[model samples]
Target: MRSMCCFSALLLLIMAPVVCQGGNILVFPMEGSHWVNMDVLLQALHSRGHSLTVVRSNKSWYIKEKSSYYNTITVSVEKAVDQKFIQKVIYEIMEYERGASRLVYLFHLIVGMFGTFLESHELLGGFVSALLDDAELTTYMKDSKFDLLLTDPCWGGGAIVAKYLNLPLVYNARWLIAGDAHLAIAPSPLSYIPVTGTRYTDRMTFVQRVNNMILHVITQIQLSWVIKDVYQKVCEKYLGPDCDYYQLMIDADIWLMRTDFVFDYPRPTMPNVIYMGGFQCKPAKPLPQHLEDFVQSSGDHGFIIMSLGTFVSELPADLANEIAATFAKLPQKVIWRYKGEKPDTLGNNTLLVDWMPQNDLLGHLKIKLFVAHGGTNGIQEAIYHGVPVVGIPLFFDQYDNILRLADRGGAKILSLSTMDKDDNFLKAIQEVLTEPSYRNNMQRLSRLHRDQQLTPMDNALFWMEFVMRHKGAAHLKAQGNRMPWYSYHSVDVALFLVGALILLLFTVFFLLRCLCAAVCKCKAKRD
Candidate 1:
């Protein structure tokens, strides 16, 4: 018995280290930005016993700092050539200057494609080229082995690295995946069945249905072009001829979307395309003492929190003056994140700062409304904190995001083009604050949006494990790749109708000819 006990103790000690060493996950987020969602995901994975390695461009400020959650890797890319030089070259080649600039813009598109092909979609081309050429990046890739390559969809390099290393790839889409049917899990109003959960009705009004159909068709065309022209060539170059771009993106072991089903109404979804919505969100943090005092000083009248996010701060001076004037007259105090030089005659009630801790400001109890440019991250934060918004969407997906929020009665959508109109700006602020319905609706959404029993971090971890346990389950997604465009749209019926019409016309022609010939024969006989 003593001998047996000794043997058992030895076995237990031997197996302990093996069980503790979990799989390695490498993460690459977009350069130069602090997307809270990505940060939460990395933290969640770390808690789950997985070792994480985060690779980022030096341009990214987030990576410059250190965190205990994961191992960090920074890749420095070359300074991009001037935008003017790129524009000139593109105009010379394409002979067009509309939309995005020709030269520099074309480089952005091509490099983006190349990055996507390489699976490092987060890193821009200039950055990717710089990293690929860097001795440090090459050395890191050669030495730091990992079990899985996880990346945000914005960075295509993750895909590239996954292909090169022949490792499993997991894509975390900051928004909806624009293309790739496998990753395209949002539901259509026209579809009768719900793809993710069956609790909600999938029906839509006729106009809504038509609009959705058109959007889907347009998305399909655009995605096809991106896959063929951008992703394919890059994949061929890095992954060799045997690799398939469509299959690589579509067949990702897991596609995690950072969107909530409650917000995206009447949309179809799939199991494989996991909706890890609000993964980056957290309960509101306590307000700073000075900010608290500022809010309390406002008394019964509330305040507005204005931020345009990080990327675009080029508000025209006239528009800024107009906003300042509008705030000057309002009863509420305003906290604006303005990067430009401070105006000399700033209103008494308005506080303009070069930077503001957005999440903390929005969480303040005195903040009655939010004024923003409707970026996804900003919108999500506002929604998470139950703050009603006045969204002035500038570009990209901001327009769609703000419109969707407005449609839900949780926010108001205004255009920057008309922001100079003091009446419009003031009226918008009044409507947002006075309207009980908007507040009620926003609170209702907040409940639904926040009711996710699992925080975004937990959801991400759960799905990550789900992928490992079940390798590429069909029940998780629609068979988008198996069907052609005709099949997807049920265009076979239209083809059948056309074929039947042709057959009927031929039959009629044949019958007429026979009757005419018979009549001629009778006439001849009579003669």
Candidate 2:
């Protein structure tokens, strides 16, 4: 047992309930800064005196950022976890992005194709082989004997490792809006729940409900295809065929969902699903001097910050110029987060930089508008700071994120494809800038979000320790995951009932026919 003396100032209060006993935790997070929620989670675990060893891909951003309580081990695979591959995932999304009027159920096809793509991707196979094939790494993990393997199931590697070592697993996924993973794990009521990236609300229309089913069914089918046969093969290759690859996911001790009713729409989560939506958002610190100077100079008009997030590319030169040209017409200064070369048509009002402290800048009082890629984290940060948004959404969940904010009256969507000639794109930027209701509505939501009983990190820490204390939190897991699809959805029961009703109807019809014939014969005899 580690002493509570290792805890820092921020953790002292929360660490009280814990008895200075914590497990050696292994975190296998997907690669990127977008895993911000996961980072906060690991930090909280570390703060509570847990020994954390994170296995990072060479490309992971967290490899260099290891602190006192945690260590990082880097592994180099033949096929690297590159941003280009992630970008390709986005581009393939473009394949289905077209003609939404005709392809209303496009997400199903997108979901189907994407799973196959990821399966065939060299990175997935290479990483799995690299880990399992490396005798030293596997031996080290076995010798160290971690009690818990913490991972976001979004990355299959986490599940693989947990299954291989027969460790207790906790699934973490970042989506205030529940995705297919959430549905599989718990009692996700599809009736009101909007399908991820679909932009529907809980009270979906009949057609929307049908579309939701399409998204859910197709996603599940695609995921299932590899989950058992292909994924199990990977496990069997190394674990001598005894490892139950699918069972690790099913037997997960807890699911730490990065969402809550406070930030998300109302939905019933499972007993084991812990809400930790705003864990990534910290209190804003002072801006860097240059940024502070720039914002201060904007004075009453204030500055608008535009970021397309970490992985997405900057706008095309022509499009960037067009957006810049529009911005030049307004009095407000624009800080655009773009790493690409400066466009020749760059306007005087725009300052293009490689990066900006997104959360800190959003917190700035002088900020007027946030032009963003409509990622959840960006939207969450904007809401946290009570800043209205002008969202130019890119692929994946961005459309849905922007739509939700727009529906809330705090944002306006300006589709990137239409930005070149569309008056609405320019109008949206102006509307969010000049509108008072946007800010007012945003502030109302910000207050509601902050009015929660516990902080996101606290909620996460409590539940994480709860899992640890109880020795894997088995009681909280629902039996629904163990049931077959036919049983879980009650399809088999419904079919049985339908068959019985059909049989009863057939017998009744036959009896009625016989009685009618007997009555006719009696009538003839009496006549």
Candidate 3:
């Protein structure tokens, strides 16, 4: 009987499916470029014992659902943020054109700004919108029975679902998560923390520091207002009146930032916020034979890879022409990801495609350099492959990303405003290709980025599982959530100023008393 029992136990141990404490992970990526990170997260979760499901659109190849993985639920939300109203406002701002319709544009800007404010409030407007779409998402949640929710900060819908379901929420911040409170995790030095890795010029003039401080103050105020008004309203509508949206915002069970401590120094990190850098993407497969041959044919004067990213597909014709003209001058071949109408006069050396396997191309040994729009994902790919870049930042966080890359000696920044200048374009490309420092720096950064104990995806998976196993883990959250904003961050500064004033008043009083005494003594002596 004992021998038979042992044999049965051995068989069960060998055959039984790995049970992982009811681990179910629901991943939500931002509208676009989010797939870049989500793909890795899926793989990491699968590697562990967790069953995973991804919720995203089919916007880019990065987010395309793979059947080999657990399950992928496609959620379709109109990319309305990039609507005509928003585009027109952006056009007016970019062109600096004031016309009879300027007031209309200004109004739209105000509305858009207000909308953005609401969008930032994960608790209020953001959450309300998601609750309204509950029918579409609830099915997935119900079927999956997720133990934890891993969502991008931008995906207020996921956050809402997590709150509604009462699941542990882990905010996967792809970029810098800047907030007035210390608990918010930023991925880059653009955050207001005076930490070490920030590249803000040490010898900055007083004027520059003042300007920076003003900018920081303005950003903090705007963000705080948006969170309170927009996010709070949505939270109250869905999560009930008793729900403290402010606390929910701060009580994120875990903050998984896609940033490395090596690249970003002097990190002002909280205990719950973990650095999960390089989770943006995975090492891609080898290039196709034909593509490999084409790259090999270029020899030492390798090809240049150019991409404007998904959001900015419709490049101005003039900009396209300038790019074409610049490519015409290069001895090496050029592979351009152009989504618009192809030009009649194409450069012989240029290869235009609607899309190219960006990661595969970047990994090519024949690819000498990359010309990019300075998107975070693109930057990561470039760094991962140890290829230098010529960054022409278009908008949003691109400006900051390009600046950081340039500061790190891994890329050269070409202001898109001046992209019309052929001299500048030519010079930028030439410098990136010829400069040995750029390559060296990229290689160094690559080492630092990859030389991690756990990849970003691993860290994300670990936390997702951690949250699942531990339940809410709300105890790890900061106490700042309960305190008023003024009391939380600025009370010390306020106290210092108040103390200085009190001390100054006391000193003045003492000086006045001494002077009176001296005058009285003089009068007595004279008498």
Candidate 4:
């Protein structure tokens, strides 16, 4: 007993430092569904003994001023990308998509939403300006002695803040200001890698490939324009003329990419990029008694769960009624997260809730299928739990996200245009429910995702701590981000080699002509 006690004391002494080694982390997060994932990340960090401080706009819709896990630094701004703004944007986009022709929809998506997109960035820029310009906030941030800055580069303000503060930067990122986060740092060949909105897969047809290239060019244009118009001016004024906003974004020590090969199409990735897709997912806990009772009532047929994600609280009334009517025909019980008007067509089998424990429900054994808006979080959760999906993609990357699963035979996509025509939505759902391949494919992906030696969350935590242990991970970052476009692409080298080859060819021809002339003159003299 004495020996055991001595050994235990020694172990406690040895493990004390490791257990208590916590770093002060500053976070700059985006609003909407982005915050949902970011909140999960923050909770994980807090649980690991790290201190966190989050910066937010006073009008932020999701980020609370008070929290059990982290401290908040609220910056006052006139305008913000809040719930109202997002809902309005989604409503307009959905309405336009449903009413217009495909080509016209494409034009509307580009031209109609461009102003709103630009305005979102402008609002974010205003928030950033407000935060940095305030002397008190700047002083407080500096005095806080933060070890690192964690941010979602979706808004671009976080990268700028990291530069101004001279902190080691890490990204909890899927999208940067422009498009997919991978495109900014990785060697993405448009031949195979599809752009965000193009919906092309690794094997694209010729026309699709052409569209991919055009979309990629448009993304570049968007990136350049946003940086120049919104972020670059602020960077130049604050971080010096040499501080390029694009470079600052790509210079982060690590990118905790919110996607894995299981969810995302395979592509080239950087050394510093750590794929942590479905990190927010875990085994389901016991559902509330009422919910469990409802789930249990379905018996052998199981149940279907539907959610349209954070931005969409409710869909259009006619669409909702159509969906309800279809669900009324189903044998399985349905639990739908909706805040819209109670549809008159809603059936006895359907339970309408304004909110749900989505992740928990996905993990349940009684789950038959997921009806989703194809948000990254929902799709990734479905993948993690091996639940087959019925994806109704609406706006933005939803189509692309759903198509990835559709190509793999794990999900079925029912576009809004065809959803109501000839009971297409009902047919799509029934097809998925009847198909064994869908569930089997999703389960196979789940196995692949889960077969990792370390959990994705643990992997993310390891890399984050690795960054803190060493002040910054300069060794892992590529210098190509700083290189000029021509130099990085080797266009200058190619031009030089071509010029040299042309000169050599000309010289050889000239020498041959001279030799022929000499030989002809000698022959004439002999004659």
Judged by lDDT, which candidate is best? Answer: 4
Best by TM-score: 4
lDDT of each: 0.65, 0.74, 0.67, 0.92
How do the residues 1-527 of candidate 2 rate in per-residue lDDT, one tens digit apiece?
Answer: 25455556448767765658777888877666546667777777877778899887776543554567678767776566577766666655543443343254364446555654555433654676777778898899889878788887765667778777878778787531124456666577777787775668677999998888877776566566656645666767767677766665567787877666645776666787777776777778999999898889887999999898878655556676787778777788889988777877777878888878899998888999999888778888888888898887766678777777777788887765565675666788888777799999889878877787898778878876776666688788778878877998899999999999999999999999999999999999999
Candidate 4, residues 1-527: lDDT per residue as tens digits?
A: 99999999999999998877999999999888899999999999999899999998889879999999999999998789988988899999898889888888888887778889989999998888999999999999999989899999988998889888989999999998879998888899999999998877899999999999998888789889989999998899889898878888799999999999988888888899999999999999999998999999999999999998988888889999999999999999999999999999999999999899999999999999999999999999999999999998998999999999999999999888889999999999999999899999999999998999999999999999999999999999888888999999999999999999999999999999999999999999999
Clashes of each: 29, 1, 12, 0
For each of the candidates, the C-alpha root-mean-square deviation to the true structure, in angstroms, is: 7.4, 5.1, 5.8, 1.5
Q: What TM-scores do the predictions have?
A: 0.75, 0.86, 0.79, 0.97
Better of 2 and 3 by lDDT: 2
Q: Encode model 1's per-residue lDDT on 1-527: one tens digit a residue.
A: 99999999999999987766566777766533334567767776787688888876555554544778787777656443233333333333222212345345335433433333333322254454455566776677767777777777654556766766656677787432353233344334445422221112245455655655554565556556656655666677667788776666655667777667656544455666667655665666777777777778888897888987665444556667777888888899888888776655469999887777788778777779999987777788777888899987654456566766787898887765565555888899899899899888888887888776677667667777665455334465567654655977679978999999999999999999999999999999999
- Pick by lDDT: 1 or 2, better one: 2
- Pull out the clashing pairs in model 4: none
Off by over 4 Å in 1: 1-21, 32-34, 65-67, 79-143, 174-229, 468-479, 482-527
